[model samples]
Target chain A: MANTQVDQNQVLPEYGPVTPADIRRAAWRHNLTLQWSWNYERMQALGFMWSILPILQRISRTKEELIANMQRHMNFYNTNPAVGSPIIFGAACALEEKGQGEVADSLKIALMGPFAGIGDTIQAILLRPIVAVLAASLAMEGSWAGPLIMFLFGLAWFALKFPQVTWGYKQGVNLVTTVAGGALDKVTEAATIMGLIVVGGFIPSIMARVTTPIKYVREVTVDGQLTEKVVELQPALDSILPYMIPIVIVGFAYWLLKARRQSPIKALLWLTVLAFACSYLGIL
Target chain B: MTYGIGIALLLGIIAYVAVVMNLGASCFWHEALIVGAVTGLIVGNVELGLMIGATLTLMSLGMWTYGGATIPDFMTGAILGTAFGALPGVGVEGGLAIAVPAALLMTQLDVLGRAITTLFIHGADKAVAEGNVRAVTWWHLLGQLPWGLTRFFPVFLAIWLGAEPVQNFINWMPEHIMKAMRVTGAVLPALGFALLLTMMPLKKYWPFALLGYILFAYLNVPMIGIALTAVAVGILYINLKEVRARG
Candidate 1:
């Protein structure tokens, strides 16, 4: 009834109808168990299938088909939750209706790895630290702008969550990958450089601070006269390398973590113990 | 140190809702600043909340749970830290010290909570076999129960039953011990940075990391300055790499 003289020759493709409501529901399901139901067996398979359940209902011909698709989607799956899954899932929905079930499954599996890389580099490794550190620095300074700023950035990034899926669906793999596909590696590389720089800057400002108040208060004779001169050791160290001890501490931690391949939790435990011991003995 | 019954319950509910946000991909509520801000509001001390949250944020700067590997649960710590830290004389530093262990311990709880979610996943599987779409949705939401309670119980205990002992412990800690904890707190971020380095690897970016250190450590550039410098470098690198790809 609502059709305004639709052209008879339009010949829409025989694919699953992706309404706005379907996308909305899919987005909701995609995020529902994002951080919650992650497991060893199937990382995001459960949640991934759940997100497209509404679409499956609309597209599948039989109960067996729906169950089969659901079971297949439940296969080992994982991705960077922010941008990767939505894009891939959107394409899968499109392909599913086109009777390219195997292609859809393989595509979902393949696309996740690179997208995971991009998402991790861009969001977790790059954007998170920059925003959180800035907010933290400001919060440390007792400014309300800290949390406010972090929230705004976080909100903006989140706003892109749904759009990623829709954009992928509309453009499909060819155009979408062409646009940002080649850029993933480049983006990941550039993001790594930025992450390193940020982490480097973070060490001295917040991470490491080793200072001692023990002043060299020995009596010295100058020009045959008895005079007492005091030189504090912290300033001396600072002159050579401001926050040098913190740098050394980070260096040691880096060695323990990377070269020795020590567990991070163990390293953290050791640091805690070292901090207590250092403070007790005044070595740090 | 104390809240009215209504306020106490309300705070518990707010904290409950906040961790629920973690159920989805949007990580807004779990951020240290946001958690701190929430608790700070409940306790009527936004400054204390920001301070506590900022401290936790720095400590957790490098933390990201990759491949379902469990890490310290700082979100719960943030809530507890701010709540306890807001008390008179308890202070932000002391509360942070308390929060440190809380976060580490909560990692175990987080892992267990995720495991419990498997039961729900199984239910969803069964629901799918039965063509029970409604049941599948319910099961999915049911899994969040353990996830939500993992956060809620800690927060409730801190407010309902934990305030007095915690506050007393803070008041009882000697000044020197507090000083040591402060030192420890300052040093904790090193571990976070170390973890980040391990995950990302310095690789060819070692120089950029070094430059970052120099900019902040020697030249005294602010964090934003370093961030801006890094952004410029990233854009330039991207442009150059894109051109190379085209070539």
Candidate 2:
């Protein structure tokens, strides 16, 4: 939300004029530092670090030039937040030195939300899940693979981080321009494809029905043997159907809170009470 | 050292509380390792504990956080279920079956914890205004304590105290009831997927969704492989369009 409204009275802290050479050197230093501590602090610091990139890009630029700079910086930032933050900061610093303000500030605000979303998805959803699955599966088999799994996962984590940093440095502005023009669209397409497959995988993994309150009405006899072919009836409306009840209730509550403009807490509270009542009344 | 039900349950409670509090860096693996090791120590099967912990972690691989929201907390479920499942006669599969429901039940606690955190955000603001860094830290920490405890202690007590009775109940449960639980386990993921799908902007990308589903569900292609193929195809499509525009 922070924009380029720099107060003239407030003396801006000087960090010297940014240059391509300076950016490249700073990026390498950042990369080395990141390789040291891959913890939460590093991650949080990375967020703050990348946030300043667009501000630099906007200084002293025409509206069109500003938009172009914004798009380019965002592309680099979007690639990977943890590693990309310093690279972006350096690039922004270079732009700031070049006196491009409008481009930098606009891009900063526009890209923050998307960058955060992408970073969380890649780290939490894709990478972490894959590592957890592989490690856990191996561990379950009684193999002394716990340490091995951890090491391998850590390797993959770094493997994914460094390339983005190098790419940002080598390509610089070209990277952002390329991404804005066509590369980003391709990435989104790929993300969509990957997301769909993940969803499909989740179907069998998460949403397969567990229980129905249906009972067999009659047994079929096949060649003097009783076959378990019985007509089942849906349990009377609800017996607190575990999975289904939660989904419907959450959906309704979310709709009320998000779409209908009801207070979120109020909606959640009401839904919880309703759920409890339905359970008590033997209807869910 | 051989541990009893009480000790195992206590460990579960502790692990749950620790994660809920955010006292340390607690991921699913960390939670499982802590709980499983404790349970294993109690049950005289530290090795088994590690194995079960690892397996459950894998089964929950795709579980993640989007924005600030996370998939259900599988840590307590994994630990308690594994402990229960690893009883004298119970095996890993049995433990898994029990753990799955326990994990599902813990979802409520997770949600509640987040709600509590929302309250603390205001307190954090107040602390910031007062320039009381210590007060702010304490408030945040205080806010997380209940969240952590609820995750650990209550569930620990429930599993520890109720294990024998629950196991007995399971032993006496009708075949149909067991079948129902299995069915519930399988269907739960579908609901999770549904939740995820509903939030996605798929109107313009319907074909990709269909293609992915078909490839995975019917054609039985690996997910990663299919994803790679889609990326390749998309790159080509974009390039072709670019060429046409230039021409």
Candidate 3:
């Protein structure tokens, strides 16, 4: 009795026909679990899904085939936890309708990085930040709008994901290829632009903080003027001064790590020790 | 129970689940949203959760795992810090300030989780070699547990026990200290970017990096414009060079 119930529960409800809605639902479910962080693994899983479409297509010839394909698609989440899962699944779905093996696989692999990059950039950098800011802005106003923000954001994410998945299934791998010529490239380019802009804007705000222990000596004169002078321990070496330590450290470390194949950790440890010693002796 | 307590519990559960699923390291948005919502729900102000989550997410925008070396486990800090932030008087900005240090400490926990999970990978390898799919699957699933738990338990426990105290602490913090925290919060993203830049092989692409910096910095060009110009210039340069060579 328990076994029978378990078997019955395993059977998902047949939604009249395997329409775009069905595909969308499947994709949303898959996306929720895909987790943007483990994208490479997710793509691999997608690759497996792509790989199995031919077999499913051969086994069925009609609407029933669609149902079977959907089932097969759902089964993928249980199998692989690799990066190309969604791509593979979408490719397989495409192949089920029309058998194009090598072309599909090639396309899937080619598009995987670009797709992942776009998805990650938009989801991570753009939408997430915008939503958070909006919500926080609302909260700052002391309105009871915080909970609403979460629900709305979740809905929006689901909305964005579902259509992409459904479209991938309905259009098949050719969807990416067809869209690739103009639309997809534009989208990717746009995303890349946004990412670059944000990261670029962060440069001065971020990187201009390289510090050194060396300091200039300033003599205070009675006329209320300050004369700056270098307090170099070795006055003869002053000409090659400012860049000497940096050049030596960078060159020596680069050679040791790149040429000699010393591990980075070991190189870093030795460098840190040398730096500390040099600093202690005021010779850095 | 008050909405605050209920929401705290919910956020704790979300934190637990996120860690368990190992989703914390994967999707900053998902983890942040979920934790934020839960905290918001408990606090009777979901908006505050969203704000805290969003700010924390931005702060961790560049945070990522490269070949399994995860830095500053943003998941824990975001969740717990948001929970603290969502408290009646503890504001999102203040919450972010607290979360930054919390995230720094959480890094150790994340590293420990990764180390533990790596051992499970070895076990899964053994299972695979033995032709035991069931064992392999089990090992794989089991391996995820430590990472998940590491993500979940600490934030849950910390928030559950320390939310009120954290609020008090926040209240007591001097204005300068808060300013410093906010400054540090803003600065950390740059550190993350620096870390990323350091890891990149920029020698061949040095021109791109320099162009990107100049376009953003001096030219004040938007990223989109820079990317378009860069691509066009790059293509033109290559074609022109080819023409010259052939001529």
lDDT top scorer: 1
The CAPRI class of candidate 2 is incorrect
- Clashing residue pairs for model 1: none
* Whole-model lDDT, model 1: 0.69
What CA root-mean-square deviation does each model show from the true structure?
Answer: 13.4, 11.1, 12.8
TM-score for chain B of each model, two decimals: 0.63, 0.57, 0.57
What lDDT does candidate 3 reach at residue B176?
A: 42
DockQ in order: 0.30, 0.16, 0.14
Model 1 bad stretches (over 4 Å): A1-16, A31-36, A171-284, B1-5, B25-27, B163-247
Sorting all predicted structures by TM-score, with the top scorer first, yields 1, 3, 2
iRMSD in angstroms, per model: 13.0, 11.5, 12.1
In model 3, the runs with Cα more than 4 Å from the true position are: A1-29, A35-88, A96-105, A170-284, B1-11, B19-34, B40-75, B82-97, B111-144, B159-247
Give the per-residue lDDT of model 2 (tens digit) for A1-284.
Answer: 13456455442332235554545554543443321111110112222232333243324233333334333332111223452444444444433444433333323322333345456566667767666666656666655565356555555544554455445444445534555645545544545545554444323322223224445557788899987766544443233332344345435644664567664335534544554444344342
Per-candidate TM equals: 0.60, 0.44, 0.46
**What are the per-residue Cα lDDT tens digits for candidate 1 across A35-77?**
4555433446667777777777666555555667666565546
Residue-level lDDT tens digits of model 1 in B1-247? 4655665576667766776675575656678788788778878889898988888888887787653456787777887788777778888788898788878767655655664564566566677777676787677666668778767766676677666664575468576665665566556556645654665556866898888889888888866678678778878878886789799
Instruction: Give the proportion of true interface contacts each model preserves, from 0 to 1.
Output: 0.59, 0.20, 0.08
State in Å the error of residue A63, model 1. 1.9
lDDT of 3 by residue, B1-247 (tens): 1134455456656766766444412333444544665566666666766666656655665554422334676667767666677666777777787777877766656645543443443353344344343554465445546666666666656665675554565468564433332222222222223322333344544455555556655676643455456556544555575689799
Candidate 3, residue B239: how far the Cα is off, in Å: 19
Q: Report the number of backbone clashes for model 1.
A: 0
C-alpha displacement of B222 in model 2, angstroms? 22
> Between candidates 1 and 2, which one is better according to lDDT?
1
